[model samples]
Target chain A: MIHLLAFGMIADVLEHPEKDWPWSADTAMLRAALIKAYPELRDLPFVIAVNMDVAGGEQPIPPGATVALLPPYSGG
Target chain B: MKNIFIQGSIAASFIGESIAKHQSKTDIGAHAIFLGQVRADVIDGQPVSRIDYTAYEDMALQKVHEIREAAFDKYPLTCMHIYHSLGSVGVGEISFFVFVSSAHRAAAFDALREIVDAIKADVPIWGKEIFAEGQGSWKVNQ
Candidate 1:
């Protein structure tokens, strides 16, 4: 299983801090699955962090990786 | 990892104490401080009462560590401290504090500006501006 975390507005949309998903080799497929499950995520400005680092959609989703959806930062 | 995250608002007493703690370091000739307070911005017809802050803790810590290291490399500084609130902070309450000390005023001023700018642009912290009536909107840095 792959663990996915959400923060900021994305967490509000997901309604939880983290969620589990069946492992998928393709990063694009995983993103698609997520958007399908949470339609509201499609419109939000965010980035995907794989293993605590920002990752591109083309990058492979490593097995059992910790993923996070991070919204644009507003820190001062 | 260094403890930079504080819950709720950063108090004036805490800021005063931080300054007092540095008094023993007489080598430092100048100190610079930057404090970020939550503004009561009016949106539409409602006014913001507070801000709810959140962050990806591990990543934020790592990023802040890198930023600190970079700042040290680029500036001549005696010490630096960065503190950010993680929970709710009401309007006019302090949400972020950055302190920099150096032997010269120039270094302290330059380092403080650079550090504060880096934190705002690079840190993965988020803020939700909550209105008086319980409604809120995610804050976006301009």
Candidate 2:
């Protein structure tokens, strides 16, 4: 199992960890973890804000300390 | 410690109060201020009515603290402040205010521009443009 966390919006997953995130796992396993976290958002249009800019365009999130799901900031 | 975030219809008063609190010092030769206001504009043929701003406060505060340190190191400034709105700001309303006080005009000008540019490029605030023509779009400081 992998650790996953979300802010601004939740992910689209059917089987979320239901526990703490930022855990460890391999690349494929973590993507599975993300898929589990937000089943609804899976394969949907979304962006991640690592620090200030949008990230994770097409690739699965890298297993590291510099990754975040950037929920679309709709507030003006 | 210093007043940074201002909201609602009273933001102007807050800006005024901040300015009033500044006393001209004989050692400082220049004081520069920049205020960014919400403007009604056209976006992709739609007219924007206002903007709503949101941010990750924890990260933003960390960035702001770094900016302060960098500004003082780069410029001979006595003090500086940055204020940004947290919610919706209607057209013609002020959304951001940056103030810089330095011992010289050149340093103050350079520092002011740097601060604004850094905030635009590095801050984690999101801007949603609400249109008067009944449409809207998300915009990031680019």
- List DockQ for all candidates: 0.87, 0.23
- Lowest-scoring 10 consecutive residues by lDDT in candidate 2 chain A? A9-18
Error of model 1, residue B65, in angstroms: 0.5
Q: What's the CA error at residue A55 for candidate 2, in Å?
A: 11
Q: Please compute the TM-score of chain B alone for each predicted structure, in the order given.
A: 0.99, 0.88
Q: Which portion of correct inter-chain contacts appears in model 2?
A: 0.16
Per-residue lDDT of model 1, residues B24-132, tens digit only: 9999999999999999999888999999999999999998999999999999999999999998999999999999999999999999999999999888999999999
CA lDDT scores, all candidates in order:
0.91, 0.64
Error of 2 at B54 (Å): 0.6
Candidate 1 regions exceeding 4 Å error are: none
Candidate 2: residue B130 lDDT (0-100) = 78
What RMSD, rounded to one decimal, does every model reach?
1.3, 5.5
